[model samples]
Target: MAQRSRVRCGHGRLVALAVMAGSLVMTGAPGASAKGAAGVRPPGDGDTPMCRLTAGPFQRQVEKDLGLPQDGEQSEQDCAAIRKLQNTYGISPADGYAGLVSHRAAVVDWATRHKATLTGCAGRSRRLVCVDQTHQLLWVQQDRKIVFGPVPARTGMPGHRTRNGSHRIYRRVEKFWSSLYDAAMPFSQFFDRGQALHASYRPIFEDPGSHGCVNLRYEDARRLWSMLHVGDGVTVWGTREGA
Candidate 1:
């Protein structure tokens, strides 16, 4: 039987499931905690949380991406816009800082805007998972129309670099227990050999990367689990930086 998904979201933007904070248990796959995607807990309190008043490193780039004054300076308007984007993508602290994660998410969003042309990955006529290692991002498209992602992803690194090529999702395990790593892999969808797409409880941008799987944020992985299934076309290309 096909797994019933709790949420059905659209492309460019998807609903992020609540995740429990400080619950990560690493099991060797750079994976997430056992809380899974169903961990329902709201972040912070109040309608407007306290914003980061300082300018982030990616301040200028994010300003341009959000169509704000490209002054490379943080402003009230800039914080609000950046925070909105952060909230939409489940980035924590959502304080409207143009930090690396926020900037990366913005870049991914910008890539999918206005139905922009995505250069790599095939299967235009059918469900296709596009992995662009150059950008450290992933997105799903069909009929040349993006259905999901352009989300931040951490692929294999260095010696364990993920192999690039066309493949298919051969298996899916909602909560896979990895004895090899003594860890838990949530929303695991195997596409090639031991490599699968799964949620990593730790921050997706953390260093050293995954063993071979495409590591997504827990919220992003949950959304991806809902969007993808066994047999979907998977195309991975480009070299993961430093790999």
Candidate 2:
């Protein structure tokens, strides 16, 4: 009888686990890669599904579980905070998009729990800010107060899409690709490759394109580099729709 009781307990545990898994699937959590009957991806696969619906308790739960920003939309401040992270850390710019990291769930949870507006801007920080290329603006904030700018910028082509996501600053190279550091100023340690914030003069207003890098005024690039630390945030959003 004792052995039979133990077996029953183990069976009960299995049932509980199954129930939890089912609940997660029904709620549309990330990592639930199970396809539908028609081989189509689930509703929550790409964008943050919770944002589409009205902000409420269910959305709060999803945010807590997934770490995303909540409420109706995304914001410029959010972009800046993510950008600061990307510039400071080594995370890919693509990772800044809403669904790339697990922390988005946490962000969502915090927003909901506090009854705060989900501005979609990552968060407020003295050391972080998001750049929205679509609007040609930079969202800078500290301690929740915000300042906006129509900063001049250049963007990638359609396929490139300026790599929307979070990344961190790993290194700062004064003299990049040349022996003399004085002539060329480039922030060499960005993204995973040759792209960086460097001095360019082909045309300031025109979108002078790079392979996948950000080109800035020499002074602007240096100033930004100086302002950031090794672990600062950086996010690059390609357009206004928060794509």
- Give per-model CA RMSD: 11.0, 21.1
lDDT of 1: 0.68
Model 2 / residue 45 / CA error / Å: 60
Q: How far is candidate 2 from the true structure (C-alpha RMSD, Å)?
A: 21.1
Candidate 2, 1-243: lDDT as tens digits: 111111100112233345434533332332222112212223343752222111222333334333446442333333334334333322232222233221323332343344333243463345555555554334344454443222344445445455677665555565554222122335443543434554443332222233345555555556666656666665667552211
Local distance difference test, candidate 2: 0.39
Please give, for residues 1-243, the per-residue lDDT of candidate 1 as tens digits: 223322211111111111122211111112122212312223366765566656776778888877888877666677778889988876776777676667767777777673467687786338999888877889888877788877788787677677799999998989775655545678888888778888876566544556778888888899999988788988898876532
- For candidate 2, which ten residues in a row score worst on lDDT? 1-10
- Model 1 TM-score is 0.66
**Cα lDDT computed for each candidate against the true fold:** 0.68, 0.39
Counted clashes in each candidate structure: 1, 38
TM-score of every model?
0.66, 0.41
